[model samples]
Target: MLYKLNLEHILFLDIETVPQKQHFTELDEDVQALWEQKTQYQRKDEFTPEEFYDRAGIWAEFGKIVCISVGYFAPKGDQRNFRVTSFYGEEIKILKDFKQLLADHFSQAKHLLCAHNGKEFDFPYIARRMVINGINLPYKLDLFGKKPWEVPHLDTMELWKFGDYKHFTSLKLLALVLGIPSPKEDMDGSMVKDVFYIENDLDRIVTYCELDVVTTAQVFLKMRNEELLADDEIKKV
Candidate 1:
């Protein structure tokens, strides 16, 4: 099925997020209490709200997307090339930019979005953030009355699950297991918050996010029994 899908129509993407503020203390008392309650089960009794605050980026309410990198395959002479681009810095501005990109180019019915664990994480997170930022939801991201089959989202993690929901796979582990290069060579998600806030290196985070998008495309190709892109074939544009 994936083999028949047009690579050009599939927009592969990944996002990087950080806690809305530089520190947990920056949040108001009400929001702080909410954050603590949200993670209570996971944190148990060992980690306090402040201690687990580094992970606030995973929650849409407590975080803001700092980067949304997208890639798609296109004809480059006689061969296909994958080009990557990113929107970063100033949360609302970047979110609006990304929304405009989708509206300007990828909004057709034939277009689809592909990401690893996107159905559970990336897709919803983006839609929720878009709403929070006052951006209209594009048809592809807005799942409101669309039938289950009508939602054109491709999740690599869900595809790999094959109906066995008992296990979950990280993109890095799946990439290594499937022979794709690890995109985490420089930094992982755990480092993204610090990279954005303390190190003040949004470019590094964007690069990391772009690499993940490329890796996701490669993983999807692998699932379809297709070839991965060569280093020469990947362009950051």
Candidate 2:
């Protein structure tokens, strides 16, 4: 499937998210009860809602996007390289800037959005966050009545599934198996919340997010049987 993709038309991306509040106690009493109900079946008889609050960022309702890093291919004569950029700071601002970028540069019907596990995670998370922030959905993310075949989106992890529902792969694992550089050099998703809220290091998260975006693109290229980009080929703008 990747054989036919025009690298120029796809916007490769990854996002970082965190719970809206620093801790479960910060949420009001009513919402706390709701979180309990939300996680009861998953939590079972183990941890309480407060004990599991750190994982709230994985759910769109209780979380907000902290960063969204995107990459695209640039042609250099006979070669193609990737350039990355990020939208971050406040969640609302990040969503606004990212939305404007899509509206301005990649709004055409042929433009595609790609990410690892994006169909289940990044894409829906972004759309839900935007709606919660009262922001209008961008054309690419506003699924509406569009048929599955008509949606301009790609998922590398989904492709790797190969119709087997029992299999699952992480982006880092895919990078390792595909011989692409692992983007989890410094911090993984588990550390993102601490790095953002405690350390107050937005740059670290942005850099990490961009690396994942690049790694994801590289994984896609490898699957397409194309040469991976050299370090010198990656230009961040």
Candidate 3:
């Protein structure tokens, strides 16, 4: 019998992160001094660590979360509904809020959390920051120590390996390779941090995040041998 997944409980999520200013200078002064002299987008230029973050919007003053977008398959439907939420505050409060959302909706379900490179970036970044903030990690995020394939985790980038792992393809590039009409065709991750920092616009961040979740869900669908849905169907929620 084919396994029947509780689709509603599978949370496909992505988080946009810029380095934390507080942690930026933890490096040696020489490195820190060089880093500070340049913008994150400008590698050749020198920067003091502090100046780099100042221009890079790495401090909490630049707002903690630009966006938190999540997606899940709808029960009995061939579609995905994604919800994008924004968190703006100190990292501690934002982490608490993020933990609460998972606790409130997914605490008891057989939840499978999905992300692109979440194993290396999103998951650990959130966990370490949550600990630094004195907040207990949500149960769903406590599976870090387990072997990669043993946990209730799915990383779409890793999933692409089934097709021969043709080099490291970015989520956007993979979508195009699969003819999924790459979302975020207008913007990339580079602009996301700046959208939050310079424009201070939460809606753009939401849009960026929502695009990621939708793309991820599409990638997941393609992996499962299901027909891919259009952007309208994918973003219905």
Candidate 4:
């Protein structure tokens, strides 16, 4: 059934986020107390709230999306060209630009958004960030009253689960097992915060995010038993 679906109708995407502030000390007193309380269970006796700040990017309330890279397949005569692009820079601007893209191009009912672990993370994180930024949710991201089957969203991780609810697979592990080329050669999710705050290399982070998009697409193609995308077919825009 996945193979029967049009590749052009799906958008594969990945996002990179970092703590709202460069450091824990940057947050005001009241917010610091809030952070301490929010992460208490996770921190436990191993680490203090301030010590766990680096992981705050996993939470929409304390994190900000710095980049969102998306890739879509476009039919090219006898072949398919996978084009990738990114929206980065100021968080509000990035959200606005991405919102415009969805409204202008992917508003149709047939269009679907795909990512690894998207249902649990990427999709909701983007939606929450959009609300926090006061941007209207695009049709694809808005799920107020849509039925389960009516939702136009896909998750490579969910597909891989195949009904095993307790199973958890990281994108890197999935790609490795599926024989798809590794996308973490340069950097990975763990190093994103330092790269953004210390190295100030957003371009690097963008490249990393785009690679994950490509990898997610490849994973979907693998699931459909389709040919993998060749290097020449992937174009960064």
User: Which is the leading candidate under lDDT?
Assistant: 4
> Per-model C-alpha lDDT, please?
0.91, 0.92, 0.65, 0.94
**Root-mean-square deviation of Cα positions for candidate 4 versus the true structure, in angstroms:** 0.9
Of 1 and 3, the candidate ahead on TM-score is 1
C-alpha lDDT of residue 212 in model 2? 93
lDDT of 2 at 169: 100
lDDT of 4 by residue, 26-51 (tens): 99999899999999999998999899
Leading candidate by TM-score = 4
| lDDT-superior candidate, 2 or 4 | 4
Deviation of model 3 at 3, angstroms? 6.9
lDDT per residue (tens digit) for residues 1-237 in model 2: 678878999999999999999999999999899999999998998998999999999999999899999999988998777899999989999999999999998999989999999999999999999999999999999999999898889999998998987788999988998888664469999999899889999999999999999999998889889889888889999
**Alpha carbon RMSD to native, model 2:** 1.0
Ordered by lDDT, highest first, the candidates read 4, 2, 1, 3
Candidate 4 Cα deviation (angstroms), residue 166: 1.1
Worst ten in a row by lDDT for model 2: 176-185
Per-prediction TM-score: 0.97, 0.97, 0.73, 0.98
Candidate 4's C-alpha runs over 4 A off are none
